[model samples]
Target: MNNMIELKNIIKIYNSKKKIKVLNRLSFSFKAGKIYSLVGPSGSGKSTLLNLLSLIDIPTSGNLRISNRNIDFNSKSDNDKIRAKKIGIIYQDNNLLPDFTAMENVYLARLSIEENKKKAMEDAKKLINNLGLSNRSNHLSSELSGGEMQRVSIARALINSPDIILADEPTGSLDTTNAKEVFKILLRLKNKNRLIIFATHNRYFANMADCKIELNSGKIKRATNARIK
Candidate 1:
């Protein structure tokens, strides 16, 4: 497998009232074609790591390479372009626009990468139907159930056909049944050409990943042959 993303001695710090260190000289390489689950207690820097991976946050120091190319964090436009072309992010809150219908929310994501509305809508409709949300595509975010909203969010994330999918507590707010359903949809998205990484507190879902990694005190401990049967 190719190394999709590589971090070299990355460090992240927050200096507010007190100097707080989140990730302390952490380094890891993520490869394509695998689903990695980041499991940790609250405040353990799982979300922080994902943010850095998504280029949503820059490391305080050290290097980040994606697709074997070093990232130039100083160039905001380049980062935005890379993010739009290579990264797809899903948030715990389902970040859908309240005023837009599910179809609109999903298709609007394509505007960042594609200019044609007709093509974008066609792609969005296929994704919505594939995710079994064809009937709910016209419903506003406020009108859909939590699981339905999450499916819409997933469709939005996939609209650009990103190479890497970063999901942070994707099912954290759902009930057990809905969480399982959402996870099933997520697992189905894994392929040999893309990378899927998610942060989760649910052990069952975490164990379903191809690799299980535990983060504690800003450090990572990966399990050997952790893929569940």
Candidate 2:
């Protein structure tokens, strides 16, 4: 199996006024072709762990390897390049450019790695169309509804054809119908060569994953496979 990401004795501490330990020596290996659900309560550091995986935040002490390559947090430029090329992230809050149209928001992500605007827009259009946003692609981000914005955010994240996808409460704010819609799209994204890790509080969604990883008190409380028959 392909080990997409490996964490060794990882720890995260925030030193503001008081030292708050978020992750306590986390060590785990995530393989490609599987979906993992990170289930934890509020302030359990689910976002913190996802941030570390995406290279947006570095751990206090530990070794992180992605696709067999060691992560060098000191190399900001290189890290940015790696993130642009390999990792896709879907935030709970759709972080789109308020002034840009839905299509523009999606295509701009491609401009980071290449200078081909034509191909970028074409790819973005295809993604948006695939997500059933062909009629709304030209609409400004501010004009879209919660579900539309979430779909656009997903299109942007997949623009790079990333090896790993990290989603933080992808459907948390949507209604039941929209949540199911967004979640169905998310489940369809799984492939043999891609690793998907999502954080969720909903038990129904958590159980849908291949494995459920529970976090408590700054450490992994339990990890159980759902398909262990």
Candidate 3:
């Protein structure tokens, strides 16, 4: 299998008054055409690992390669461009702009890669329709339900057609019904050339992944019978 993302001896540390280590020389590789579930307790560095994978946060000491290209953490501008072009991020909070409508929220992300408003809106509309959120496209973020807002966020993430998607608790705040619905949508996005990694505390959702990874005390372990193919 081709490795889509590879981390070599990754270490993340936060220094305030004292040194706090998050990831301790962690190494892993993710392959395309698979969904990975990162399972761990609240403080087990799940979010931190996702942040690093998304290039939003840098590892204190490590080498990260995406699609065989080495990442230069010191180049903020370059990393930002890579993120906009190749990486999509979904947050648990749905991180939509309160003042923008659902349509605006989804299309605005596309503007980063394409400056044409008409083209961006056209693509966003198609994604929104496919996600079954067309009726709520004009509604403001605050007016939409939690599930609706999350659907919009998913549309936004997909608008860029990224090769890798990093979702941090995509359905953490939703009810059981809504959470299952969102998970189905996520599963439908799986493709032979795309890699989807999500961090979740829900066991049902985790088991649905192609591989289940457990993070503990800055280390990672693959659970038994993980369906990696």
Candidate 4:
């Protein structure tokens, strides 16, 4: 299998008045083209792990390589470039710009990676349509329903054609039907040559992943293949 991400002896620490260890020498390798679900109770370091993977937060100690290149977290520009072009991140909260229209939000992601505005708009239009937001493209994020907003978020994430997608509770805010719709789009997006890492508390949704790893006390219990249909 082709490796998309490699984490070796990773450690994360939160320090203010005291030091709190989150990840304790965690080691794992993730390959492309399969959906990976990270399951854990609240504060089990699932968010911390996803933050590190998404390059938004740096690991206190460890080596992180993406697409075979080691990342230097200290360089903001370098990280930004890699993140915009190589990775797509979906937050639990739809982090859409409330003032921007759905099309604008999706187009912004494409523009961040590509220089040509016309090309980006064309691509964004297709993605918005595919995500079932074509009719709402001109509407501001605040005007859309919860599910519509989430789909727009997904379209924005995919606009850059990222090799790795890091989704944190992607369906946490949607209704049951909407959640299922979102998951279906995600599963269809998964290929044998890309990586999809999602963190969720929903067992039913987690069971749909190719591999499920439950996190507890900064460590993974075990990783197993899913048997659910």
**Candidate 2 lDDT score at position 196:** 95
Indicate the TM-score of model 2: 0.98
lDDT of 2 by residue, 130-223 (tens): 9999999999999999999999999999999998999999998999999999988998999999999999998988888899999998889999
Judged by whole-model lDDT over C-alpha atoms, candidate 2 comes out at: 0.94
> Weakest 10 consecutive residues, lDDT, candidate 1?
218-227
| RMSD, every candidate, angstroms | 1.0, 1.3, 1.5, 1.0
Model 1 agreement with the true structure over 105-213: per-residue lDDT tens digits: 9999999888999999999999999999999999998899999999999999999999999999999999989999999999999998899999999898888999888
Which is the better candidate, 1 or 3, if ranked by TM-score? 1
The candidate with the higher TM-score, 2 or 4, is 2
Query: What's the C-alpha lDDT at position 72 in model 2?
Result: 94
| Candidate 3: tens digits of C-alpha lDDT, residues 1-229 | 5899999999999897988898999999899988899999898999999999999999999999999999999999999999999898899999999999999999999998889999999999999999998899999988999999999999999999999999999999999999999999998889999999999999888888998999988988655435534
lDDT per residue for candidate 4 within 160-180, as digits (tens), equals: 999999999989988899999
Report the number of the highest-lDDT candidate: 2
**Per-model TM-score versus the true fold:** 0.98, 0.98, 0.97, 0.97
The Cα local distance difference test for each model comes to 0.91, 0.94, 0.92, 0.90
Kindly report which residue pairs in candidate 1 clash with one another. none
Looking at model 2, report the run of 10 residues with the lowest lDDT sum.
220-229
**Residue 31's C-alpha lDDT in candidate 4?**
90
